[model samples]
Target: MSKWKRLQENSLLLLPSVVLTLALGIYPLLWVLRYMFYDYAGYGNELFIGLDNFRRLMKDTQFWDSVGNTFVFAGGKLLLTIPLSLILAVILNGRLRGRGWLRAIYFMPTVISTAVISVVFYIIFNSYNGMVNQLLLKYHVINAPIDWMGQEHAMLTVILVAVWGAVGNYMLLFLAGLQSIPNDLYESASIDGANATQKFWSITIPMLGPVMQMIVMLAIIASLKGYESIMVMTEGGPIGRTEVMYLYLYKLLFPVSTGSAVDQQIGYGSAVGFATAVIVGIITALYYYLSKKMNKVF
Candidate 1:
């Protein structure tokens, strides 16, 4: 085909995605931008009160608390998930018997629904009559049943669940990175009197640098945006202990049950959404800059 004809055909193929983006992404964003300056409750008249929502957001303690909780949850999940995933990837990448079965088992969770996982975990960790408590009691691990959903331990419970759901996905990524590394490098290192540890540090890690960087970036964004599992498990409470940024924004935009109905705050919710986006964007940009600098060094 002629170059012009090929280009025309490619544009035709891309038309659906372009149209969907404009309709679902661009239009909603514009609508939110417009309403951020108004006081609308998803109905009635929207009164223009420019910057009022932003002003309210500045002093909103609950939302700020949720932001702090998000960092904690994300930090805990990353600290556990990334290292565990890399370790699993390294192990499973080796030529062990039934390694294929092990890989399939580990990756199975990644294909499962997050909501289903959360619900199953909820039942497993229930404060009373849960499998966890039952097992602990059976083994005399605890004197009494601990409330996993209570304020004191709710965040910890949520973090564990988040890590469980996330590790499998990152493991697959790490496995791909591990496999891409040529065996020749390890052989050369072996000839140089390098041990397994030395090979991992010098060859495996450095060889996987590009993939590692991308995986870390993706993990950070996913962790920051994570709220679905938290929502299903904790509903951002016992007293907002497990609340995260997106969940807080969701509560503002939609009605939530917290011993009472939460009135929709569309205008303020839009402002909160914008602020949340800004926070995520800043973190992502900072990481990108640091990664670029690290690339220069190594």
Candidate 2:
């Protein structure tokens, strides 16, 4: 067969997956677009509404707050996870005794269920008798146990927990990048009278540029998808101080916010979902453009 015909025949193997995606994914998305311009109660006839939901969303303070919260959560995780993962990867790159076990210990958290981790962290940060509070109190850091889940500290607590759970996965990515780097480069640097720190800064970091950029993009995308941990731990509570975009979208369809009832908000929720999709699209496009530019620079 000719190349074009051969390719067409091979694509037949993926027919099932394409069909499944259209049925479950594409159809629901198109349905959302249709209903975005109409008001429905999930049961009754959808009344046509033009741009009303978008206008209201433009004026929502709570939704804007969620945008800010989402950025904070994403930024906090990136700030902590990247450097820590890189540091651990660098340490493990050396020939140390028990290196295999140490790598396993760091990677253990990634395999654990996020639900279980969130639950464990929730208890560990509890006000009265949690491990953190007890340790601080024993050291006489404070006379009273601090409320980690309260308004003043809820977002910080959530960010810390997110960082802790996320570091392991990113560390593996960085470790792979480190290992792929040829040993000859380091040896050559040493022959040229380069110290460990000098070789690391000149060779290791420069070589890791592309890999680091990819890790950053992956972390950002995964952070955008974060909802389950916050849902299981905080439920966007303490007066919505820790509410991110995903949780806010979730609350729209499930719980009846004081501003609007559930039955009248099908279009509203659809609008929110579409808007969030647009934001994700913009971020993804920006990431690809930046990655291309950085690749040229590196």
- Please give the CA lDDT of all the candidate structures: 0.92, 0.86
The residue pairs in collision within model 1 are: none
After best superposition, candidate 1 residue 193: deviation in angstroms? 1.8
TM-score of 2: 0.91
Model 2: how far residue 280 lies from native, Å:
2.4
* Tens-digit lDDT string for candidate 2 (138-257): 999989999999999988888888888888889899999999999999999999999999998999999999899889989988887687678778887788888888788877776654
lDDT of 1 by residue, 202-279 (tens): 998998899989999999999999998989899999888899999998888876543227788899999999999999
Highest TM-score scorer: 1
What C-alpha RMSD separates each model from the true structure?
A: 1.5, 2.7
Mark the 10 consecutive residues where model 2 has the least summed lDDT. 256-265
- Model 1 residue runs over 4 Å out of place are 1-4, 256-260
**Against the true structure, whose lDDT is highest?**
1
**How many residue pairs collide in each prediction?**
0, 0
For every model shown, what is its TM-score relative to the native structure? Answer: 0.96, 0.91
